[model samples]
Target: KDPKACTILLRGASKEILAEVERNLQDAMQVCRNVLLDPYLLPGGGAVEMEVSHRLTERSRAMTGVEQWPYRAVAQALEVVPRTLIQNCGASAIRVLTSLRAKHTQEGNSSWGVNGET
Candidate 1:
């Protein structure tokens, strides 16, 4: 009904480029539609993983014995998500991980994450 509200008109030099643009536009449009239907969007990046890892790690300390090991292992594994994100961004994994860990542990800020731009 609203002609100019949400429309895509792509023009390209070659068929291949046009096709690629059309495909990408379709994919983006689908994402927009899905978001509109289900507005509950999870936090992007590794924030969720870090939060889960932090909670798991804290709970692991309460366990009596060997049961704690699994929780600790899973928590450590969850941390790999953000660590890999940092390394993929051409940053020092060790430095970023250390900083993140300190922020979460010492400062009690579980949401702290490495800025990819750095």
Candidate 2:
């Protein structure tokens, strides 16, 4: 669960690949904002609620797309994207999602706990 380790490993990865990943992520973010926040897409409260659900689903899809390219590029670069990156990304993502959930729970908005608590 050491983020520094992940950072160092990523640093060793080609800067070109890393830059591509960053660009992809930025594009995904833009798509998310466009689809989720467009006033014309949801002009009412119930519409907004449904749009939020749709947006969340699409966000997952977007993230998958963003990760896919870098994953393939990394695999090509190293002949295999290290299992470490795969595991570390999964772990780090879970940690981040759980932390956000905890924040929401503390605010009396949700209640969920992740495994791997230490």
Candidate 3:
């Protein structure tokens, strides 16, 4: 019974909800522990995926006829992440994805992510 330690009592209207809350809390604690063990974070909301897609698309442009298709295909596949993010936010996926791609193409702009709050 350490007074300084974090503690909380959660109440749910149903057993299922309480179990879900417990699971979520446990997951959050695990994430905190992992963060303490190794402090690092990947770009959220498809930023890294978009960056990879941009690089692959750029690389495809430099290759010969047949060799470029695979790079292009993979680049297109990776775009699904950001596109889904935009669609979930009730925005035009095509327009936002085009903008996101353009942003990632610029200098020192690899961290640009899809705006999920829209």
Q: Candidate 1 at residue 59, lDDT?
A: 97
Q: Report per-prediction Cα RMSD to one decimal.
A: 5.3, 19.8, 4.9
* TM-score, prediction 3: 0.64
lDDT of 1 by residue, 1-80 (tens): 75758756899999999999999989998999999999876544576687788789889999988989999999999989
lDDT of 2 by residue, 1-118 (tens): 6464433222327889888877777798798888878834323212222233333444455566566565444323431222233344455644544353334334333322222332
How much is 102 displaced in model 2, in angstroms? Answer: 44
User: Which predicted model would earn the best TM-score?
Assistant: 3
Candidate 3 per-residue lDDT over residues 14-90, each given as its tens digit: 99999999999999999999999999966668999999999999999999999999999999999999888889999
Stretches of candidate 2 exceeding 4 Å from the true structure: 1-12, 39-118
Question: Judged by lDDT, which candidate is best?
Answer: 3
Clashing pairs in 3: none
Q: Each model's C-alpha lDDT?
A: 0.82, 0.43, 0.90
Displacement of residue 116 (Cα, Å) in model 1 is: 0.7
List TM-score per model, in order: 0.57, 0.24, 0.64
For candidate 1, give the lDDT of residue 46. Answer: 78
